[model samples]
Target: MGKGKNKTHEPKNERQQRGANGHSARQNHKHMEMKYDKSEKMKFPVKLAMWDFDHCDPKRCSGKKLERLGLIKSLRVGQKFQGVVVSPNGQGVVCPNDLEIVEQHGASVVECSWARLEEVPFNKIGGKYERLLPYLVAANQVNYGRPWRLNCVEALAACFAIVGKMDWASELLSHFSWGLGFLDLNKELLEIYQRCTDADSVKKAEKEWLEKLEMETQERKSHTKKTDIWMMGNINRRGNGVQSDELESGEDSEQSGLENSEQPIEYDALGNAIHVDSVKSRIMLSGVSEDEESDFEENEKPVNYDSLGNLI
Candidate 1:
């Protein structure tokens, strides 16, 4: 009995040892797999072309060509791209893998994605002046040698205005022109200045547009009034509230009286002349005195007016 018990305990201990070893091995394997996955996700640098499209006519190329040139791509959200990576002295760009890309080609790293470039329409790409204008303005201040920046600044201002970003357009004008002159005195900058000045002109033009809108509104109101009059006439004819025949009869009677007599005759809907034979008799019947009436009229006069002439 003792030998059988010992044999059973020895086998049980071996099984427990095996189970523990298997569990540890599985845990180790999982940890290694997680580390490997993390490393694989990290981006390594690669060499890419930096093309200049500042003067390139986009009209001459297909969409595919634009993509190849890296001109069309914009930055993707949460994606790392390239930039100039400027140092204290403003000179850098050692490893291609070390760099990230940005929208502007001027940056050191390839900063945009093929997706962003392809997503935006070709026509709209050049019209994104608001996005590019501030950089141009800043670059102009840093390096005036680049005459193209001026043109870019102007284009951006105009683009902003066209897109209904008047505040931005105004800001660009105020910053570049320094408040006094429209033209940048730099001869090289003139080309760009001419293009951008239109943004300010656009704001002024909005006033004329508003005046046109007002005129249109007035014309619409007049048309609506005429329609209302016709509707009212029809309503009267249909006897909705009053009869048109009665109104017409009254007008006819007044015209006949005017032709026959020198005195003017005003008739009610029943065609009876509204003749006030005695104004004093009516006032007396109402128990109102002339002096009280005069006092009331004087009190009702507007005090703010210089005189009756001023009221008119």
Candidate 2:
């Protein structure tokens, strides 16, 4: 009897130990999972928000993507916020002077299509300060290489960069593959805008940059024109089987002899024809005589020209 009793107790103890080991393992796994969750949680540096108008494709919309990643918060239409509002009709441009307001109140952007900008109820949008972003190139695939066509994240990033929150800007843009490239594409322009102290300075900087761009474009066009002219001249000379020196000499002789040659018949201001006779050293009327010209009436018909500049 004692041996049998001891055997029964041994089995019970073994079962109990096994149950305890299994529970401990399960608890250890649960703890590990919780620890991982904490580590993986993303912490945004600033309180970034936006008002999405659902005007873009869900898959392609940067604002929605950021919201899914918990990087940005979305507000309803006409919702009130004390942050700096990025609007197309902003009162002024975002600059370093607004850094304090941005840091204190955070920043928010209006997410809508550039086409439907007029449909947006700007008056209902609430914000302590409404500001426009300075000129910045888009890095998103859709509007890549286009200026002032930034998506929500890009606009926010630009504001952050202008306010001296470069790390924040970088972090905001880091989510997208082409995001960081935006800063690189507009590196010089951004740097110039970032250095400005206020809206006035930013405006001045933008003006200067625009002027420089315009000048460069004009220079490029002039260079292209000169190149085209030279190529045409060269082709003409080659086609005529003439050397450059010979062509120049021929042109000079032709110009000098032109004064002595009989000139072609031409029209005067009154539509009367005048014939030039170099030998007689006098002008003669041909198409209409002076008395007949006075009696002529002006034609009221519309004149048309063909593509080749011939009267049609």
Model 2, position 22: C-alpha lDDT score:
35
Q: Which regions of candidate 1 are displaced past 4 Å?
A: 1-72, 77-196, 233-312
Per-residue lDDT tens digits of candidate 2, residues 113-225? 78888767777775878998878889999999898889999999999899888898899899899999998998898889889999999989998988998999998876564
TM-score of 2: 0.64
Residue 225 error, candidate 2, Å: 1.4
Computed on alpha carbons, the lDDT of every model, listed in order, comes to 0.31, 0.65
CA error at residue 232 for candidate 2, angstroms? 4.1
Error of 2 at 147 (Å): 1.3
CA-only RMSD, every prediction: 26.7, 20.4
State the lDDT of candidate 1 residue by residue for 179-242, as single tens digits.
1132333323223333333434433344454577589999897656444333221333221243
